[model samples]
Target: MAQREVIVGSRVGLHARPAALFVKTVSAQPVKMTIRKGDGAPVDARSILRVLALGAKHGDTVVLEADGEGAEEALDAVATVVAEDHDDPA
Candidate 1:
């Protein structure tokens, strides 16, 4: 598995909008991915509810993990989504 720690950049953290955006971003990747906050059990990066439940607020550190072909690339992309605050909640 590959892992990366990213700080929540959005003012509201990975809440509704951010979480939704995160889900969308990771869902596009082919490799399976998991996200975790603190020492919490990793949750499906593709699930909005699971990702939101992480309660990762602004400044909080979260870890993303993946195991499969191109796991590193997939994790990196997820990290970009997290770090960039790329959420379009409607």
Candidate 2:
């Protein structure tokens, strides 16, 4: 399994559009990925509802996990999205 930690960068955190984008990215990965707020239990990364339920706010640390092939790439991809400021205009 592969795991990584990233800080949520969206000004409003992983909600609404940001959550949707994050879930879409996770779903596109070759491997399934799970995410959790801090040390909380992992939830399906592909589910917008589960992700929204996380209530991950800006600057909150989240852990992502995945297994099987391409796990590293999958983690990296989602990590990038997690660390991006979706609310940014730039």
Candidate 3:
């Protein structure tokens, strides 16, 4: 498995829009991914509900993990999205 730890950058955290964007990124990846807030149990990163339910607040550290081919790249891509400040003007 590959892993990437990132700090949430959106002002509102992983709420509606941010969570949806993160899930979209995860969905695009070839490998299955899971995310965990701090030491909490991991949840499917592709699930918007699971991600929003994590209640990941701004500045919170979250760990993304994936196994299989291209896991490292997949984690990196998803991590980038998770760490971006989606609330800001794009």
CA lDDT, every model vs. true structure: 0.85, 0.94, 0.92
| Winner by TM-score | 2
Better of 1 and 3 by TM-score: 3
The residue pairs that clash in candidate 3, if any, are none
What lDDT does model 3 reach? 0.92
* Candidate 1 lDDT tens digits, 1-90: 678999988778998777887888898999889899989999888888888888898889999999889899888877877886544355
User: Which residue pairs collide, candidate 2?
Assistant: none
lDDT of 3 by residue, 1-90 (tens): 778899999899999888988988899999999999999999999889899999999999999999999999888888888888978865
The regions of model 1 sitting more than 4 angstroms off are 86-90
**Candidate whose lDDT is highest:** 2
Candidate 1: deviation at residue 21, Å? 1.1
Worst 10 residues of 1 by lDDT: 81-90
What's the lDDT of the predicted structure labeled candidate 2? 0.94
C-alpha positional error of residue 13 in candidate 1 after TM-score superposition, expressed in Å:
0.6
Model 1: lDDT of residue 26? 91
Name the lDDT value of residue 42 in candidate 2: 95
